[model samples]
Target: MTYCLALKMNEGMVFASDSRTNAGVDQISSFKKMRTYNNGTDRVIVTLTSGNLSITQSVVNLIEQRANDPDVPNVWNAKSLFDVATLFGECLREVRKETAAYLDQTKVDMGVNFIVGGQVAGEPQRLFLIYSEGNFIEATEETPFFQIGETKYGKPVLDRFMQPETTLVNAIKCALVSLDSTVRSNISVGLPIDLVSVKPNQFEFNSQYHITEDDAYFSHISTSWREGLTTLFDGLPAPDGFESNTQAAVTESAQPLGTPVAQTSTQHSQTLTPASVNASVAPVQPSSTQTEAESSSQDNQSSAPTTSLMHAAQNNQPAQRSPAVAANQQNTK
Candidate 1:
């Protein structure tokens, strides 16, 4: 498992990924997931990869090996970011084809994913998510971010805060928080995190950071975000009718067995209280006319109303009577 995310904003593009990968619990390792290709003058491309490590590594190695070849189009020589994404998808498919010879498709997961983004000389900055089938989709205004690999834990933060108009610095903060949220919840996505930022048409990275466990700013983000959420939750108002619910519970518990409970504002019907909410019965001193079994049956009848009353009070509805209990009450009436 892994976590990688990219944000495309009006100011530029931001990319981030965790370093941890594992074959199993016993075989944990760290590897760089972000790769860069740039010729300072003409173009710049950044890729964050996830899935089978060997497949991603092979695809990246292939791109680098063929980048300088004069006869073919490559990431370095591609005219636009779209062309670069296409070339990357092609290379990824080629790598999978090579591995498919011996590996069983059903038994082994050969799927891979990439977040490819940056600018070429004539085009604006663009971001894409390249899939295992050599297909890709670009980020747009409504969906200004993309995430791959263990995406659920970190996605709420990004969905709430990410926007096309967000500034570069704020986007970086959002990305780091998103990663931190994931790292705390998932063991597979650990740090040190690699981050890169690029401005539109700059054709080179504007900022790069590698955040480790002890990095002061990253530590502050983790602590502050946790504390802030705690404070916010503590300060939130309680739901309506909470006080009534609490009072009803207290009243229900205080009543003696066979005591008739008064209808509260929240309860829609009358009820008989039992000795305890758990429906337990204290040992009964059998009457002269009653046997031990008869006393036990009477205890069960008395406790049967406890469940229906508690549920009705919570839902502010009428208590539903069981058929046997209803018939017994009718006979008494």
Candidate 2:
């Protein structure tokens, strides 16, 4: 597994990727997943790859080789990001055609993905998420970022913190936080991350950072993020009906043992508008008042009344039932 993401913002764009790859628990290894192609004055491409190492390496090698061959239509001479991405897809397809058939027999997956972001001379800056099958979609104004590889764990922060109007530095900080979340939650994504930044129309990488375990800034970010989450969690109000300070009056302090006073409703709760009961509905437990003897006696009585009550509620005919009884009956069903 891997985690690679790119952000396209008002100031510029940021690209980041982790370095760890693993075949199994004992087969962990490190590999640089980010590759850059540049013509210095016209176009610059930064790609963060994930998936089968062989497939990704082959794709990169092919792209680089063809990029240097003047006869080939490469990123350097490509007029647009679309052309560059199409060329990338072609490179991916070429690698797949060469290796997938042989690898399939050995039961090795040829899957690979990429985050392609940067600029071409005349057009605006862009970011794309390239699929394993050589298809891709570009980032849009509504969602100005793309992430490839083990995407879920880090998604929450990105969704919360990123915006097209965000400064490039803040966006990169969010990206680092996003990476930190993935690294913490998943063993397959570890670091020595590669980060690259491209300013709008620069046609060259504006900056790059190689982050390793000993990096102080990353460590600080990790610490600050942890504290922030902790603070946020602590400050969040307890559920609307829940009282945090109540301790059930120590049970023994209750005048009677059936149900303590502290457990009773402080104010009448709004009648529950029961959602349609489904398979996940819990089996309702009988109250202490519904003892075996009492239940057996009541079994002889018409449950026909409760049935009518349930139908009334479901049909929106306000046949008033005591809140407690209504909740109990619904749970029973």
Using lDDT, give the best candidate's number: 1
| Candidate 2 lDDT over residue span 1-333, tens digit each | 899999999999999999999999999999999998887888888888999999999889888888788888887778888888898899999889988779989999788898888888888888888998899999998998888789999999889888888998898899999999999999999999999999987877888999999999999999999999898887776543234433222222223223323434543433332121122223345568768879786777645444456788789775755555767999999
Count of clashing residue pairs in every prediction: 0, 0
Model 1, 60-118: lDDT tens digits are 99998888796798876788889889898999888888889767755788888999988
Error of 2 at 273 (Å): 11
Q: What is the TM-score of each candidate against the true structure?
A: 0.75, 0.75
Residue 18 C-alpha lDDT in model 1: 97
